[model samples]
Target chain A: MIPVTVLTGFLGSGKTTLLARLLKSPEFARTAVIINEFGAVGIDHDLVEAGEESFVQLETGCLCCTIRGDLEATMADLVARRADGVVPPFERIVIETSGLADPAPILNAIMSEGARGSGLALGGIVTTVDAVTGLATLAREAQSVRQAAVADRLILTKSDLAGEAADLRVRLAALNPRAPLSEALFGEIDAGVLLYTEYDRLDDFHTHTHHVHADDIQCIAIRRSEPMRALTLTLLLEALADHCGAGLLRLKGIINVAEYPHRPAIIHGVQHIFHAPAWLEGWSTADHDTRLVLIGRGLSEAWVLNLIAAIEAEIAEIAPQQAPAPL
Target chain B: MDEALLALITSSLALWERAGDVRREAGGAIALESEGHEVRITRAAPDVPFRWSITIDGRARVASSVPGLLRVLRAGLDPDFRPSRVRIAPIGITPS
Candidate 1:
């Protein structure tokens, strides 16, 4: 599946500027960019330079609202064009949404379509925040808060203009403690941080831990060394989606399922939307523990722990009763 | 009946890069003149799916949606703009 990274932020937050610089990277040479502007005309298309085998298509409308359907349609079109050799063969895709938009709907469109075998996987979400006024925007707009909350990597832009930004860091951690926060010096960002990987990279999980809490948003990490039954994992996620809904901003994990202990399952979810379990061919390390990082508002780590234990016990009870005698 | 449509048109203009300014004229009519081209938009009768009639370069066209209308305007005013076709996926993806 081709990985598609979502780049989002608030208006004047320097998303386009970062994208313009990102396109120039030798690392992103084969990446196709889809630029969505929140108005009748597209001004961002003019700002971003199209590189070889790389072109930016503009979606005209709010990404979170009237044109969300268009976003899905656009994805299918892009894949078809790539298959037919109408466009350059790109290994990945990057969607840059309008600054004033909510990112949840856009994320849902991609994950749902990707599950249909369009050969697209949600690479990761990279949200840009203008260090100068990011705190104000987050305080004023729910969309801004959600945008920052869902990112896998949050890029704080124009940090040179702002001093220290210690308060902004604290607020960002409170809103999304799971996502590793970094500053982009004048739109210059490291491409590797935004690209989607197989969850093998230890660096991603090791980068941060839950440090601060605000706005009822908190990051919860669950790790169990015992290999879990796949059925129990599904049951747990179903319960999560059934109960959590939109408060669950994002869920990412690399799990060791007992039924498929040889390979690992990469789990990703945004609110009620979730990608089908992406089965990896192999494990990343000798330590095969299940590690899950969830960023959510009003979610309880204690509840999740109790729920997992209950399901594991119930499954263990039933498997023994239904077991076949050794021949 | 068409106040929302007018607001969308105005907001779209403000967001688009090439667009200059949107002007509201007498009788609730709206006009946008940018890059030496003028576009006048008014809501069409309710019977048609195309909700609005847009007149540009002395030629009139009907648009069924805001995105459709944006296409019409881009075709008229932006010489470098090219329209891309979009289609929905064939099957629904499920969480396995």
Candidate 2:
């Protein structure tokens, strides 16, 4: 499946700036980028440099709502053209949604349309938060909160202008504990880390030191040394998927499952629904630690920590039941 | 398990498009019953080798594994079912 990354953020959150930088990278040489701007005058599209490959500017109101039909038609056309060899063969697609857009509908379009959705797997969702005024914006703009909530990787932009980003990081974490927060220096980061592997790389279970935006919100990371038993992880995921799936917004991680140790399982979930975990040949990085980051609204850090501990303990006691021969 | 069985489940789920309701019950169970067919999804015991088991119309069906179960579900719901590609991947491979 082709991976498609969705980029969402509030107004002036540096989404366009980030996209501009990313499009220039050699990593995006084979990428097809779709930029959607709200107004008729699409200036943001002008800012980004497009290679000989496909670069579409969608100026159809709100992409998820008013222009859904148009967006679908555009995607269909892109697919048809690509299939017919009418366009360059792009390996991946990235959508830069307008600042005011809601990403849920956009995702629904890709997932429900099996041919279209299946053909292009959701690589991940990336949302940008303006470091200087992010806390106030999130507090006042519910969409901003929702945008951050659904991100697999939250890129904190304009950190240099802010006094200190530690407080802003905390607030973002509280809104969406499952997303791994990374700072973007002048809208740029290592292409290897920022470009590919969308939501699949977010490690919500591990606690790493981050420049927390505020002290009230705690960002924690958990890492497991050994492959976790499949049943234990499944149960834990199911419970989370059942009770607080919506709150989860986004969850991404590479898990070392005992059932399939040689091949790591990559998991991605949005809200309550989760895609069936995909198997990868081996760990992408030399470090095999099971790392996960959780960003959510008022999610109990201690409760989550205890839950993981309890599940780990239960895994040891779950022996397979044996039965006598049925001769 | 086969194309016919898969079509049956897809039709039933597609029927509820207007309602937009998806149901998953306790103990990781899912049931779908319609005019003539029924489907139930249950988790298998760890020793079974398969992670999931699905029964169609009260009759046990065979799926080699969880990915296989997803394949079955996709066949039932999706009109187009090429195992490697889903509904949205670019049909042709040429770079544009």
Candidate 3:
């Protein structure tokens, strides 16, 4: 599956500035960009200097709300064009959502059945939070909060202009404790940081505390030393989706499956949509413990922990009964 | 075992942010009432392959696992609930 990264933030949050910098870097040489603008006339494309053959501008409406179908269709068209050699063979795709858009629906589009069938996989979410007005925006805008909450990486843009970002950093940490924050001055930052999508090296997973924000958004991390049964993991995800619904925003983890000791499974989900577990060749480090980070609204850390324990206990009871007898 | 199961059910209700009450009934069955809906959960007979029998609002269904039970409960309680389907894809991008 071709990996697709989503670039999202609130209005004037420096999404285009970051994209322009990324496009100039050699790391994004073989990348295709889909820039979604909310208004009638699209100008973000003009500001970006990517190869025209691989660049797409969606000016219909907000990619999250009105033009979701268009987004899917555009992706399919890009894949078809690439296969037909109509455009450059881009290794990955980056979707820059409108500043005002809620990224959940756009993410759903990329992970939708049609997009998956077209060989598209979610790479990660990169949300740009303007340091000057980020705190105020996050305070008043629900969309901004959701963008920051679901981001895999949060970029603090224009930090040079807005001195003393300590307060904003604290606020962002409270809202999303797992996503690593990077400061970008004049949109100049290491391009490799934004392109790294592998979940194997989740160093930030160490923050295992439950952080609850005023908007009912919270981040809960679950860690277990014992390996979990694959069935238990499946059932746990199913139960979470069935009950939590949209309240469960983003869940990503590296699970140590009992059946596969050496090869850990990488799981990711946005809202109700979850990608199937991806098995790694081997554990990245000696730490093979299961670490899961859930960012959402009104999530209970104890409940999730208890739920996993209950499922594991049930599995243990049934495994013995279902074991094959010795011949 | 029953206590853990009851705790899970209660926590499940709380996770959904719904006002509900879960209590053990007379015959070792669990009863859940929320938003004018009634649910009864009982262990299946030893001879049956299913693990639990769940009856919601006079409708009966058998769940072979805890996940199945949650699905049934969500369908009965939340009218707009849709189970998120997981799809397996290739782990990473294959360069052309």
Largest TM-score belongs to which candidate?
A: 3
Q: Using lDDT as the measure, which candidate wins?
A: 3
Model 3: per-residue Cα lDDT over A1-327, one tens digit each: 788999999999999989998888888888889988888888888899886445655555788778668889999999999999988998899999899998888877887778878998788899999999999999889999999999988999999999978999999888887778998987898998778774733534565545566468988887888877767777788777765668888888888777667777777777766766766777767888888888888788878887887787777778756532211
lDDT of 1 by residue, A1-327 (tens): 888889999999998999899889888888889998988988999999978979888887887887556777888889999999999998888999999888888887877744346878777888898899999988998889988988888889999999788899989977877677888997788877777553634224653334345886777877778777666676667656644556788888887776667777777777756666777777756767788887777676655665576555545544666432211
TM-score of each: 0.73, 0.60, 0.85
Tens digits of per-residue lDDT, candidate 2, A103-130, equal: 7667655543542443766777889999
Q: Residue B90 lDDT in model 3?
A: 26
The best-first sequence of candidates by DockQ reads 3, 2, 1
Deviation in angstroms for A95 in model 2? 0.9
Q: In order, what DockQ does each candidate have?
A: 0.01, 0.03, 0.31
Of 1 and 2, the candidate ahead on lDDT is 1
| Chain A superposition TM-score, candidate 1 | 0.92
Q: For candidate 3, give the docking quality class from DockQ.
A: acceptable
Alpha-carbon local distance difference test for all models: 0.74, 0.62, 0.81
Clashing pairs in 3: none
**lDDT (C-alpha) at residue A113 in model 2:** 51
